[model samples]
Target: MTTAALGPNRTSRLAARRGRQRRWHRNRQPIGLLYVAPFAVLFAMFLVWPTIYGFYLSFTDRNLAGASAPSFVGLANYLEAFADQVVWRSMGNTVWFTVLTTIPLVILPLVVALLVNLNLRGQWFWRLAIFMPFLLASTVVSQIFTWLFNPDLGLINAALGSIGMTGPAWLQDPKTAMTAVVIATVWWTIGFNFLLFLAALQNIPAQIYEAASVDGASAWRQVFLITLPLIRRTVLLVVALQVLASIKVFDQIYQMTGGGPANSTRAILMYVYDTGFSNYRLGYASAISYIFFVIVVVLSLVQVRFFSRKADR
Candidate 1:
Protein backbone atom coordinates (compact mmCIF):
# COMPACT_ATOMS: atom_id res chain seq x y z
CA MET A 1 0.00 0.00 0.00
CA THR A 2 2.83 2.43 0.94
CA THR A 3 4.82 1.70 -2.30
CA ALA A 4 1.77 2.28 -4.53
CA ALA A 5 0.99 5.56 -2.74
CA LEU A 6 4.60 6.85 -3.20
CA GLY A 7 4.58 5.91 -6.95
CA PRO A 8 1.60 8.19 -7.64
CA ASN A 9 3.28 11.07 -5.70
CA ARG A 10 6.58 10.70 -7.63
CA THR A 11 4.74 10.68 -10.97
CA SER A 12 2.90 13.89 -10.00
CA ARG A 13 6.22 15.61 -9.18
CA LEU A 14 7.71 14.74 -12.63
CA ALA A 15 4.64 16.13 -14.38
CA ALA A 16 4.94 19.40 -12.41
CA ARG A 17 8.62 19.76 -13.40
CA ARG A 18 7.79 19.41 -17.12
CA GLY A 19 4.96 21.95 -16.79
CA ARG A 20 7.33 24.52 -15.25
CA GLN A 21 9.91 23.91 -18.01
CA ARG A 22 7.31 24.51 -20.74
CA ARG A 23 6.13 27.71 -19.06
CA TRP A 24 9.71 28.97 -18.81
CA HIS A 25 10.28 28.35 -22.51
CA ARG A 26 7.07 30.18 -23.41
CA ASN A 27 8.13 33.20 -21.32
CA ARG A 28 11.59 33.43 -22.98
CA GLN A 29 10.16 33.31 -26.51
CA PRO A 30 8.31 36.61 -26.08
CA ILE A 31 11.42 38.34 -24.71
CA GLY A 32 13.42 37.30 -27.77
CA LEU A 33 10.68 38.61 -30.07
CA LEU A 34 10.51 41.87 -28.12
CA TYR A 35 14.22 42.48 -28.77
CA VAL A 36 13.72 42.25 -32.55
CA ALA A 37 10.46 44.24 -32.71
CA PRO A 38 11.92 47.74 -32.81
CA PHE A 39 14.25 47.10 -35.75
CA ALA A 40 11.53 45.26 -37.65
CA VAL A 41 9.07 48.12 -37.18
CA LEU A 42 11.60 50.76 -38.31
CA PHE A 43 12.71 48.75 -41.34
CA ALA A 44 9.13 48.31 -42.49
CA MET A 45 8.15 51.92 -41.83
CA PHE A 46 11.17 53.60 -43.42
CA LEU A 47 12.58 51.31 -46.10
CA VAL A 48 9.84 48.97 -47.25
CA TRP A 49 6.93 51.43 -47.29
CA PRO A 50 8.80 54.18 -49.16
CA THR A 51 10.09 51.73 -51.78
CA ILE A 52 6.61 50.35 -52.52
CA TYR A 53 5.01 53.80 -52.55
CA GLY A 54 7.64 55.11 -54.94
CA PHE A 55 7.03 52.23 -57.32
CA TYR A 56 3.28 52.89 -57.21
CA LEU A 57 3.87 56.60 -57.84
CA SER A 58 5.93 55.72 -60.93
CA PHE A 59 2.84 54.39 -62.77
CA THR A 60 0.62 57.38 -62.05
CA ASP A 61 0.60 60.91 -63.48
CA ARG A 62 1.23 62.63 -60.17
CA ASN A 63 2.40 66.19 -59.65
CA LEU A 64 3.01 68.62 -56.80
CA ALA A 65 0.66 71.32 -58.10
CA GLY A 66 -2.98 70.90 -56.96
CA ALA A 67 -4.57 68.41 -54.54
CA SER A 68 -5.88 66.28 -57.41
CA ALA A 69 -5.67 62.51 -57.37
CA PRO A 70 -3.09 60.84 -59.57
CA SER A 71 -4.24 59.46 -62.89
CA PHE A 72 -2.91 55.97 -63.56
CA VAL A 73 -0.80 56.05 -66.72
CA GLY A 74 0.84 52.59 -66.58
CA LEU A 75 4.13 52.60 -68.58
CA ALA A 76 3.61 55.96 -70.26
CA ASN A 77 6.24 57.77 -68.23
CA TYR A 78 8.93 55.19 -69.07
CA LEU A 79 7.97 55.29 -72.74
CA GLU A 80 8.23 59.07 -72.80
CA ALA A 81 11.60 59.04 -71.05
CA PHE A 82 12.93 56.44 -73.47
CA ALA A 83 11.82 58.46 -76.47
CA ASP A 84 13.16 61.76 -75.10
CA GLN A 85 16.50 62.86 -76.54
CA VAL A 86 17.50 64.90 -73.51
CA VAL A 87 17.01 61.94 -71.17
CA TRP A 88 19.32 59.81 -73.29
CA ARG A 89 21.88 62.62 -73.54
CA SER A 90 21.85 63.14 -69.77
CA MET A 91 22.34 59.41 -69.21
CA GLY A 92 25.33 59.47 -71.56
CA ASN A 93 26.89 62.34 -69.66
CA THR A 94 26.32 60.62 -66.32
CA VAL A 95 27.96 57.42 -67.56
CA TRP A 96 30.86 59.41 -68.98
CA PHE A 97 31.40 61.23 -65.70
CA THR A 98 31.22 58.03 -63.66
CA VAL A 99 33.76 56.31 -65.88
CA LEU A 100 36.16 59.23 -65.97
CA THR A 101 35.95 59.94 -62.24
CA THR A 102 36.09 56.32 -61.06
CA ILE A 103 39.52 55.70 -62.64
CA PRO A 104 41.42 58.56 -61.00
CA LEU A 105 39.44 58.24 -57.78
CA VAL A 106 40.51 54.60 -57.43
CA ILE A 107 44.10 54.85 -58.73
CA LEU A 108 45.45 58.09 -57.29
CA PRO A 109 44.28 57.26 -53.77
CA LEU A 110 45.90 53.83 -53.79
CA VAL A 111 49.19 55.35 -54.99
CA VAL A 112 49.05 58.06 -52.34
CA ALA A 113 48.25 55.48 -49.66
CA LEU A 114 51.27 53.43 -50.68
CA LEU A 115 53.59 56.45 -50.56
CA VAL A 116 52.18 57.52 -47.22
CA ASN A 117 52.74 54.01 -45.83
CA LEU A 118 56.49 54.34 -46.35
CA ASN A 119 58.87 55.05 -43.45
CA LEU A 120 58.50 58.82 -43.71
CA ARG A 121 58.40 61.64 -41.15
CA GLY A 122 55.13 63.34 -40.15
CA GLN A 123 52.91 60.44 -41.27
CA TRP A 124 49.98 61.70 -39.22
CA PHE A 125 50.26 65.15 -40.74
CA TRP A 126 50.20 63.79 -44.27
CA ARG A 127 47.17 61.60 -43.51
CA LEU A 128 45.33 64.48 -41.81
CA ALA A 129 46.05 66.85 -44.69
CA ILE A 130 44.82 64.36 -47.27
CA PHE A 131 41.63 63.60 -45.35
CA MET A 132 40.78 67.22 -44.44
CA PRO A 133 38.94 67.92 -47.68
CA PHE A 134 36.56 65.01 -47.04
CA LEU A 135 35.30 66.68 -43.87
CA LEU A 136 34.15 69.84 -45.73
CA ALA A 137 30.51 70.10 -46.74
CA SER A 138 29.89 69.36 -50.41
CA THR A 139 28.33 72.78 -50.94
CA VAL A 140 31.34 74.51 -49.41
CA VAL A 141 33.80 72.57 -51.56
CA SER A 142 31.74 73.15 -54.68
CA GLN A 143 31.42 76.90 -54.01
CA ILE A 144 35.17 77.20 -53.38
CA PHE A 145 35.98 75.34 -56.58
CA THR A 146 33.42 77.37 -58.50
CA TRP A 147 35.28 80.54 -57.57
CA LEU A 148 38.63 78.93 -58.35
CA PHE A 149 37.44 77.80 -61.80
CA ASN A 150 36.28 81.30 -62.79
CA PRO A 151 37.90 82.23 -66.11
CA ASP A 152 38.41 85.95 -65.45
CA LEU A 153 39.79 86.34 -61.93
CA GLY A 154 40.14 82.73 -60.71
CA LEU A 155 43.30 81.57 -58.95
CA ILE A 156 43.44 78.50 -61.26
CA ASN A 157 43.47 80.71 -64.35
CA ALA A 158 46.09 82.99 -62.83
CA ALA A 159 48.32 80.02 -62.02
CA LEU A 160 47.93 78.59 -65.53
CA GLY A 161 48.69 81.95 -67.12
CA SER A 162 51.79 82.26 -64.94
CA ILE A 163 52.94 78.92 -66.38
CA GLY A 164 52.43 80.36 -69.94
CA MET A 165 49.38 78.11 -70.65
CA THR A 166 45.99 79.53 -71.48
CA GLY A 167 43.19 78.12 -69.32
CA PRO A 168 39.79 77.16 -70.71
CA ALA A 169 36.58 78.74 -69.43
CA TRP A 170 35.90 75.96 -66.93
CA LEU A 171 32.30 76.78 -66.02
CA GLN A 172 31.39 78.84 -69.12
CA ASP A 173 32.62 76.38 -71.73
CA PRO A 174 30.40 73.34 -72.32
CA LYS A 175 33.41 71.24 -73.35
CA THR A 176 35.35 71.61 -70.10
CA ALA A 177 32.58 72.02 -67.52
CA MET A 178 32.14 68.29 -66.89
CA THR A 179 35.90 67.84 -66.67
CA ALA A 180 36.09 70.59 -64.08
CA VAL A 181 33.42 68.87 -61.98
CA VAL A 182 35.30 65.57 -62.17
CA ILE A 183 38.50 67.25 -61.01
CA ALA A 184 36.75 68.87 -58.06
CA THR A 185 35.05 65.60 -57.01
CA VAL A 186 38.33 63.72 -57.13
CA TRP A 187 40.15 66.23 -54.95
CA TRP A 188 37.28 66.49 -52.48
CA THR A 189 36.56 62.76 -52.01
CA ILE A 190 39.79 60.92 -52.81
CA GLY A 191 40.83 61.35 -49.18
CA PHE A 192 38.24 58.86 -47.96
CA ASN A 193 39.47 56.22 -50.37
CA PHE A 194 43.05 57.01 -49.43
CA LEU A 195 42.32 56.49 -45.75
CA LEU A 196 40.64 53.18 -46.46
CA PHE A 197 43.66 52.04 -48.45
CA LEU A 198 46.02 53.25 -45.75
CA ALA A 199 44.18 51.28 -43.09
CA ALA A 200 44.24 48.13 -45.20
CA LEU A 201 47.91 48.65 -45.93
CA GLN A 202 48.65 48.94 -42.24
CA ASN A 203 46.70 45.75 -41.44
CA ILE A 204 49.14 43.80 -43.61
CA PRO A 205 51.85 42.24 -41.42
CA ALA A 206 55.23 43.98 -41.60
CA GLN A 207 56.88 40.58 -41.33
CA ILE A 208 55.55 39.60 -44.76
CA TYR A 209 57.32 42.50 -46.45
CA GLU A 210 60.44 41.87 -44.40
CA ALA A 211 60.41 38.23 -45.54
CA ALA A 212 60.05 39.33 -49.16
CA SER A 213 63.05 41.61 -48.72
CA VAL A 214 65.07 38.80 -47.17
CA ASP A 215 64.31 36.72 -50.27
CA GLY A 216 65.86 39.52 -52.43
CA ALA A 217 62.55 40.80 -53.88
CA SER A 218 62.72 44.33 -55.20
CA ALA A 219 60.14 46.91 -54.04
CA TRP A 220 58.18 46.76 -57.33
CA ARG A 221 58.28 42.96 -57.33
CA GLN A 222 57.09 42.82 -53.73
CA VAL A 223 54.26 45.23 -54.52
CA PHE A 224 53.01 43.17 -57.46
CA LEU A 225 53.57 39.73 -56.01
CA ILE A 226 52.50 40.32 -52.42
CA THR A 227 51.14 43.76 -51.50
CA LEU A 228 48.58 44.04 -54.30
CA PRO A 229 47.44 40.47 -53.87
CA LEU A 230 47.06 40.89 -50.11
CA ILE A 231 44.89 44.03 -50.26
CA ARG A 232 42.66 42.86 -53.10
CA ARG A 233 39.55 43.20 -50.92
CA THR A 234 40.26 46.84 -50.04
CA VAL A 235 40.85 47.70 -53.69
CA LEU A 236 37.50 46.21 -54.66
CA LEU A 237 35.76 48.06 -51.83
CA VAL A 238 37.26 51.41 -52.92
CA VAL A 239 36.30 50.78 -56.53
CA ALA A 240 32.74 49.87 -55.61
CA LEU A 241 32.38 52.97 -53.42
CA GLN A 242 33.71 55.26 -56.14
CA VAL A 243 31.39 53.74 -58.74
CA LEU A 244 28.27 54.20 -56.59
CA ALA A 245 29.27 57.71 -55.50
CA SER A 246 30.02 58.77 -59.06
CA ILE A 247 26.67 57.42 -60.22
CA LYS A 248 24.64 59.38 -57.65
CA VAL A 249 26.64 62.60 -57.92
CA PHE A 250 24.16 65.40 -57.20
CA ASP A 251 25.36 67.88 -54.58
CA GLN A 252 28.65 68.76 -56.26
CA ILE A 253 27.07 69.14 -59.68
CA TYR A 254 24.16 71.07 -58.22
CA GLN A 255 26.40 73.52 -56.41
CA MET A 256 29.15 73.88 -59.01
CA THR A 257 27.59 73.92 -62.48
CA GLY A 258 23.82 73.65 -61.81
CA GLY A 259 23.90 71.44 -64.93
CA GLY A 260 24.58 74.55 -66.98
CA PRO A 261 26.72 75.46 -70.05
CA ALA A 262 24.13 73.90 -72.39
CA ASN A 263 23.54 70.84 -70.18
CA SER A 264 27.02 69.53 -70.86
CA THR A 265 27.56 68.62 -67.21
CA ARG A 266 23.96 67.50 -66.65
CA ALA A 267 23.70 64.16 -64.82
CA ILE A 268 20.78 61.77 -64.49
CA LEU A 269 20.20 63.12 -60.97
CA MET A 270 19.86 66.64 -62.35
CA TYR A 271 17.50 65.33 -64.97
CA VAL A 272 15.36 63.76 -62.25
CA TYR A 273 15.32 67.02 -60.30
CA ASP A 274 14.33 68.99 -63.38
CA THR A 275 11.50 66.60 -64.20
CA GLY A 276 10.05 66.32 -60.72
CA PHE A 277 10.41 69.85 -59.32
CA SER A 278 10.86 72.21 -62.27
CA ASN A 279 8.49 70.47 -64.70
CA TYR A 280 6.19 69.03 -61.97
CA ARG A 281 6.16 65.62 -63.65
CA LEU A 282 6.44 63.58 -60.49
CA GLY A 283 5.41 60.23 -61.96
CA TYR A 284 7.86 60.49 -64.87
CA ALA A 285 10.67 61.56 -62.56
CA SER A 286 9.90 58.69 -60.19
CA ALA A 287 10.09 56.25 -63.09
CA ILE A 288 13.48 57.61 -64.14
CA SER A 289 14.68 57.41 -60.54
CA TYR A 290 13.55 53.80 -60.24
CA ILE A 291 15.27 52.87 -63.50
CA PHE A 292 18.51 54.44 -62.33
CA PHE A 293 18.16 52.70 -58.97
CA VAL A 294 17.71 49.35 -60.68
CA ILE A 295 20.77 49.93 -62.85
CA VAL A 296 22.87 50.71 -59.79
CA VAL A 297 21.60 47.60 -58.02
CA VAL A 298 22.47 45.37 -60.96
CA LEU A 299 25.89 46.95 -61.37
CA SER A 300 26.65 46.54 -57.67
CA LEU A 301 25.69 42.86 -57.82
CA VAL A 302 27.97 42.34 -60.83
CA GLN A 303 30.88 44.02 -59.09
CA VAL A 304 30.33 41.94 -55.96
CA ARG A 305 30.45 38.76 -58.01
CA PHE A 306 33.63 39.88 -59.77
CA PHE A 307 35.36 40.85 -56.55
CA SER A 308 34.17 37.72 -54.72
CA ARG A 309 35.67 35.52 -57.42
CA LYS A 310 38.97 37.38 -57.21
CA ALA A 311 39.09 37.12 -53.43
CA ASP A 312 38.41 33.40 -53.61
CA ARG A 313 41.35 32.94 -56.00
Candidate 2:
Protein backbone atom coordinates (compact mmCIF):
# COMPACT_ATOMS: atom_id res chain seq x y z
CA MET A 1 0.00 0.00 0.00
CA THR A 2 1.05 3.63 -0.55
CA THR A 3 2.24 5.49 2.59
CA ALA A 4 -0.98 7.67 2.67
CA ALA A 5 -3.23 4.57 2.33
CA LEU A 6 -1.21 2.78 5.04
CA GLY A 7 -1.62 5.83 7.39
CA PRO A 8 -5.44 5.75 6.99
CA ASN A 9 -5.51 1.97 7.70
CA ARG A 10 -3.36 2.41 10.83
CA THR A 11 -5.64 5.27 12.03
CA SER A 12 -8.75 3.07 11.59
CA ARG A 13 -7.10 0.22 13.62
CA LEU A 14 -6.11 2.62 16.43
CA ALA A 15 -9.65 4.10 16.51
CA ALA A 16 -11.16 0.62 16.67
CA ARG A 17 -8.88 -0.36 19.59
CA ARG A 18 -9.77 2.83 21.49
CA GLY A 19 -13.51 2.23 20.89
CA ARG A 20 -13.26 -1.33 22.23
CA GLN A 21 -11.44 -0.15 25.37
CA ARG A 22 -14.09 2.52 25.96
CA ARG A 23 -16.91 -0.01 25.63
CA TRP A 24 -15.16 -2.41 28.01
CA HIS A 25 -14.68 0.36 30.56
CA ARG A 26 -18.32 1.43 30.25
CA ASN A 27 -19.47 -2.18 30.72
CA ARG A 28 -17.24 -2.69 33.78
CA GLN A 29 -18.51 0.50 35.49
CA PRO A 30 -21.95 -0.97 36.26
CA ILE A 31 -20.34 -4.05 37.85
CA GLY A 32 -18.18 -1.75 39.97
CA LEU A 33 -21.27 0.23 40.95
CA LEU A 34 -23.14 -3.01 41.68
CA TYR A 35 -20.36 -4.11 44.03
CA VAL A 36 -20.64 -0.74 45.85
CA ALA A 37 -24.48 -0.68 45.78
CA PRO A 38 -25.05 -2.21 49.22
CA PHE A 39 -22.81 0.30 50.92
CA ALA A 40 -24.33 3.13 48.91
CA VAL A 41 -27.85 2.09 49.93
CA LEU A 42 -26.94 1.93 53.62
CA PHE A 43 -25.05 5.23 53.40
CA ALA A 44 -27.94 7.00 51.71
CA MET A 45 -30.56 5.51 54.03
CA PHE A 46 -28.69 6.27 57.24
CA LEU A 47 -26.28 9.12 56.66
CA VAL A 48 -27.54 11.08 53.67
CA TRP A 49 -31.23 10.87 54.59
CA PRO A 50 -30.70 11.77 58.24
CA THR A 51 -28.43 14.66 57.35
CA ILE A 52 -30.99 16.06 54.93
CA TYR A 53 -33.83 15.55 57.40
CA GLY A 54 -31.77 17.11 60.19
CA PHE A 55 -31.06 20.16 58.05
CA TYR A 56 -34.78 20.47 57.31
CA LEU A 57 -35.62 20.06 60.99
CA SER A 58 -33.23 22.87 61.86
CA PHE A 59 -35.48 25.47 60.27
CA THR A 60 -38.67 24.33 62.04
CA ASP A 61 -40.13 24.30 65.56
CA ARG A 62 -40.42 20.56 66.06
CA ASN A 63 -41.00 19.51 69.61
CA LEU A 64 -41.48 15.84 70.34
CA ALA A 65 -44.33 16.54 72.80
CA GLY A 66 -45.98 19.28 70.78
CA ALA A 67 -49.49 18.57 69.41
CA SER A 68 -49.10 20.41 66.12
CA ALA A 69 -47.01 19.26 63.23
CA PRO A 70 -43.64 20.94 62.79
CA SER A 71 -44.09 24.38 61.28
CA PHE A 72 -41.27 26.23 59.51
CA VAL A 73 -39.95 29.15 61.52
CA GLY A 74 -37.43 30.27 58.93
CA LEU A 75 -34.19 31.40 60.74
CA ALA A 76 -35.81 31.53 64.18
CA ASN A 77 -33.92 28.48 65.49
CA TYR A 78 -30.60 29.67 64.09
CA LEU A 79 -31.19 33.13 65.47
CA GLU A 80 -32.02 31.65 68.85
CA ALA A 81 -28.87 29.51 68.67
CA PHE A 82 -26.81 32.63 68.00
CA ALA A 83 -28.32 34.31 71.05
CA ASP A 84 -28.17 31.25 73.31
CA GLN A 85 -25.50 31.87 75.91
CA VAL A 86 -25.30 28.18 76.81
CA VAL A 87 -24.63 27.22 73.19
CA TRP A 88 -21.84 29.80 72.94
CA ARG A 89 -20.41 28.71 76.30
CA SER A 90 -20.51 25.06 75.26
CA MET A 91 -18.77 25.93 72.00
CA GLY A 92 -16.08 27.78 73.97
CA ASN A 93 -15.61 24.73 76.18
CA THR A 94 -15.31 22.51 73.11
CA VAL A 95 -12.64 24.81 71.67
CA TRP A 96 -10.82 24.80 75.00
CA PHE A 97 -10.92 21.02 75.12
CA THR A 98 -9.57 20.78 71.57
CA VAL A 99 -6.73 23.18 72.33
CA LEU A 100 -5.90 21.40 75.61
CA THR A 101 -5.87 17.93 74.05
CA THR A 102 -4.36 18.55 70.60
CA ILE A 103 -0.76 19.17 71.77
CA PRO A 104 -0.53 16.02 73.92
CA LEU A 105 -2.27 13.88 71.33
CA VAL A 106 0.12 15.01 68.59
CA ILE A 107 3.41 15.33 70.51
CA LEU A 108 3.21 12.80 73.35
CA PRO A 109 2.39 9.95 71.00
CA LEU A 110 5.39 10.83 68.84
CA VAL A 111 7.62 10.80 71.95
CA VAL A 112 6.17 7.49 73.18
CA ALA A 113 6.48 6.00 69.70
CA LEU A 114 10.13 7.07 69.57
CA LEU A 115 10.82 5.50 72.97
CA VAL A 116 8.99 2.24 72.11
CA ASN A 117 10.77 2.07 68.76
CA LEU A 118 14.13 2.08 70.56
CA ASN A 119 15.97 -1.20 71.15
CA LEU A 120 14.93 -1.37 74.79
CA ARG A 121 14.22 -4.25 77.13
CA GLY A 122 10.61 -5.51 77.12
CA GLN A 123 9.54 -3.36 74.16
CA TRP A 124 6.41 -5.43 73.72
CA PHE A 125 5.36 -4.68 77.30
CA TRP A 126 5.86 -0.95 76.78
CA ARG A 127 3.82 -0.99 73.55
CA LEU A 128 0.98 -2.86 75.25
CA ALA A 129 1.08 -0.65 78.34
CA ILE A 130 0.84 2.52 76.26
CA PHE A 131 -1.86 1.33 73.86
CA MET A 132 -3.98 -0.73 76.28
CA PRO A 133 -6.02 2.26 77.43
CA PHE A 134 -7.12 2.97 73.84
CA LEU A 135 -8.71 -0.46 73.60
CA LEU A 136 -10.96 0.22 76.62
CA ALA A 137 -14.54 1.32 75.95
CA SER A 138 -15.28 4.98 76.73
CA THR A 139 -17.66 4.01 79.55
CA VAL A 140 -15.06 1.71 81.14
CA VAL A 141 -12.34 4.32 80.89
CA SER A 142 -14.62 7.07 82.23
CA GLN A 143 -15.72 4.95 85.22
CA ILE A 144 -12.11 4.14 86.02
CA PHE A 145 -11.12 7.83 85.94
CA THR A 146 -14.24 8.82 87.90
CA TRP A 147 -13.02 6.70 90.77
CA LEU A 148 -9.47 7.96 90.40
CA PHE A 149 -10.64 11.58 90.46
CA ASN A 150 -12.73 11.08 93.56
CA PRO A 151 -11.97 13.90 96.02
CA ASP A 152 -11.39 11.85 99.16
CA LEU A 153 -10.69 8.15 98.59
CA GLY A 154 -9.36 8.34 95.01
CA LEU A 155 -5.83 7.24 94.24
CA ILE A 156 -4.92 10.70 92.96
CA ASN A 157 -6.03 12.36 96.17
CA ALA A 158 -4.53 9.59 98.27
CA ALA A 159 -1.19 10.10 96.59
CA LEU A 160 -1.43 13.84 97.27
CA GLY A 161 -2.21 13.13 100.91
CA SER A 162 0.93 11.00 101.13
CA ILE A 163 2.89 14.02 99.90
CA GLY A 164 1.23 16.17 102.62
CA MET A 165 -0.78 18.07 100.02
CA THR A 166 -4.49 18.23 99.44
CA GLY A 167 -5.96 17.35 96.05
CA PRO A 168 -8.85 19.58 95.03
CA ALA A 169 -12.16 18.15 93.80
CA TRP A 170 -11.48 17.26 90.17
CA LEU A 171 -14.91 16.50 88.75
CA GLN A 172 -16.86 18.82 91.04
CA ASP A 173 -14.77 21.94 91.16
CA PRO A 174 -15.46 24.32 88.25
CA LYS A 175 -11.75 25.14 87.97
CA THR A 176 -10.59 21.54 87.74
CA ALA A 177 -13.54 20.03 85.83
CA MET A 178 -12.29 20.55 82.27
CA THR A 179 -8.72 19.93 83.37
CA ALA A 180 -9.73 16.51 84.68
CA VAL A 181 -11.55 15.74 81.44
CA VAL A 182 -8.50 16.78 79.41
CA ILE A 183 -6.22 14.56 81.49
CA ALA A 184 -8.47 11.50 81.10
CA THR A 185 -8.85 12.14 77.37
CA VAL A 186 -5.11 12.49 76.82
CA TRP A 187 -4.38 9.27 78.71
CA TRP A 188 -7.14 7.29 76.99
CA THR A 189 -6.57 8.35 73.38
CA ILE A 190 -2.78 8.86 73.30
CA GLY A 191 -2.27 5.17 72.58
CA PHE A 192 -4.04 5.29 69.21
CA ASN A 193 -1.86 8.18 68.11
CA PHE A 194 1.14 6.36 69.54
CA LEU A 195 0.46 3.32 67.35
CA LEU A 196 0.10 5.58 64.29
CA PHE A 197 3.40 7.32 65.05
CA LEU A 198 5.09 3.97 65.69
CA ALA A 199 3.87 2.66 62.34
CA ALA A 200 5.21 5.79 60.62
CA LEU A 201 8.50 5.45 62.48
CA GLN A 202 8.85 1.78 61.49
CA ASN A 203 8.35 2.70 57.84
CA ILE A 204 11.38 5.02 57.98
CA PRO A 205 14.39 3.33 56.39
CA ALA A 206 17.16 2.36 58.86
CA GLN A 207 19.77 3.25 56.23
CA ILE A 208 18.79 6.93 56.50
CA TYR A 209 19.68 6.87 60.20
CA GLU A 210 22.88 5.00 59.46
CA ALA A 211 23.83 7.61 56.85
CA ALA A 212 23.19 10.36 59.42
CA SER A 213 25.26 8.50 62.02
CA VAL A 214 28.11 8.09 59.51
CA ASP A 215 27.96 11.85 58.97
CA GLY A 216 28.43 12.22 62.78
CA ALA A 217 24.99 13.71 63.32
CA SER A 218 23.92 13.52 66.95
CA ALA A 219 20.75 11.54 67.82
CA TRP A 220 18.75 14.68 68.64
CA ARG A 221 20.02 16.38 65.51
CA GLN A 222 19.11 13.36 63.42
CA VAL A 223 15.60 13.39 64.89
CA PHE A 224 15.15 17.08 64.14
CA LEU A 225 16.52 16.87 60.59
CA ILE A 226 15.64 13.39 59.39
CA THR A 227 12.96 11.77 61.58
CA LEU A 228 10.63 14.76 61.92
CA PRO A 229 10.87 15.78 58.28
CA LEU A 230 10.12 12.28 57.07
CA ILE A 231 7.14 11.86 59.43
CA ARG A 232 5.72 15.34 59.01
CA ARG A 233 2.72 14.05 57.05
CA THR A 234 1.86 11.51 59.77
CA VAL A 235 2.15 14.20 62.45
CA LEU A 236 -0.29 16.40 60.52
CA LEU A 237 -2.65 13.50 60.08
CA VAL A 238 -2.60 12.73 63.83
CA VAL A 239 -3.21 16.38 64.67
CA ALA A 240 -6.20 16.63 62.33
CA LEU A 241 -7.70 13.41 63.64
CA GLN A 242 -7.13 14.46 67.25
CA VAL A 243 -8.74 17.86 66.66
CA LEU A 244 -11.88 16.29 65.16
CA ALA A 245 -12.10 13.68 67.93
CA SER A 246 -11.66 16.32 70.61
CA ILE A 247 -14.36 18.52 69.08
CA LYS A 248 -16.85 15.65 68.98
CA VAL A 249 -16.09 14.66 72.60
CA PHE A 250 -19.33 13.61 74.29
CA ASP A 251 -19.27 10.12 75.81
CA GLN A 252 -16.37 10.70 78.21
CA ILE A 253 -17.58 14.09 79.45
CA TYR A 254 -21.19 12.92 79.56
CA GLN A 255 -20.33 9.80 81.53
CA MET A 256 -17.83 11.43 83.87
CA THR A 257 -19.03 14.98 84.54
CA GLY A 258 -22.48 15.02 82.90
CA GLY A 259 -21.65 18.66 82.08
CA GLY A 260 -21.55 19.42 85.77
CA PRO A 261 -19.75 21.97 88.02
CA ALA A 262 -22.26 24.59 86.80
CA ASN A 263 -21.91 23.25 83.23
CA SER A 264 -18.27 24.27 83.16
CA THR A 265 -17.30 21.27 81.06
CA ARG A 266 -20.41 21.30 78.85
CA ALA A 267 -19.18 20.58 75.35
CA ILE A 268 -21.10 21.45 72.16
CA LEU A 269 -22.26 17.86 71.70
CA MET A 270 -23.48 17.77 75.27
CA TYR A 271 -25.41 20.96 74.64
CA VAL A 272 -27.00 19.37 71.59
CA TYR A 273 -28.01 16.35 73.66
CA ASP A 274 -29.51 18.54 76.36
CA THR A 275 -31.44 20.56 73.82
CA GLY A 276 -32.79 17.68 71.76
CA PHE A 277 -33.42 14.89 74.24
CA SER A 278 -33.49 16.52 77.66
CA ASN A 279 -35.38 19.71 76.82
CA TYR A 280 -37.40 18.38 73.82
CA ARG A 281 -36.24 21.29 71.66
CA LEU A 282 -35.43 19.11 68.66
CA GLY A 283 -35.57 21.87 66.08
CA TYR A 284 -33.24 24.23 67.96
CA ALA A 285 -30.90 21.35 68.76
CA SER A 286 -30.70 20.38 65.11
CA ALA A 287 -29.89 23.99 64.20
CA ILE A 288 -27.09 24.11 66.74
CA SER A 289 -25.76 20.76 65.45
CA TYR A 290 -25.85 21.94 61.84
CA ILE A 291 -23.93 25.06 62.81
CA PHE A 292 -21.28 22.96 64.52
CA PHE A 293 -21.26 20.61 61.56
CA VAL A 294 -20.55 23.55 59.26
CA ILE A 295 -17.67 24.59 61.49
CA VAL A 296 -16.20 21.09 61.36
CA VAL A 297 -16.58 20.94 57.60
CA VAL A 298 -14.83 24.30 57.20
CA LEU A 299 -11.97 23.14 59.45
CA SER A 300 -11.58 19.92 57.45
CA LEU A 301 -11.48 21.87 54.19
CA VAL A 302 -8.85 24.25 55.55
CA GLN A 303 -6.71 21.35 56.77
CA VAL A 304 -7.05 19.61 53.39
CA ARG A 305 -6.04 22.78 51.56
CA PHE A 306 -3.06 23.29 53.90
CA PHE A 307 -1.83 19.71 53.34
CA SER A 308 -2.38 20.00 49.61
CA ARG A 309 -0.21 23.13 49.49
CA LYS A 310 2.45 21.45 51.62
CA ALA A 311 2.36 18.38 49.36
CA ASP A 312 2.72 20.54 46.29
CA ARG A 313 5.87 22.12 47.70
Top lDDT prediction, candidate number: 2
Q: Write candidate 1's Cα lDDT for 127-185 as tens digits.
A: 88888999999999999999999998999999999999999999889999999999999
Please give the lDDT score for candidate 2: 0.93
Which regions of candidate 2 are displaced past 4 Å?
1-23
- Report the poorest 10 consecutive residues by lDDT, candidate 1: 26-35
Q: Which residue pairs show collisions in model 1?
A: none
Misplaced by over 4 Å in model 1 are 1-27
What RMSD does model 1 have?
10.2
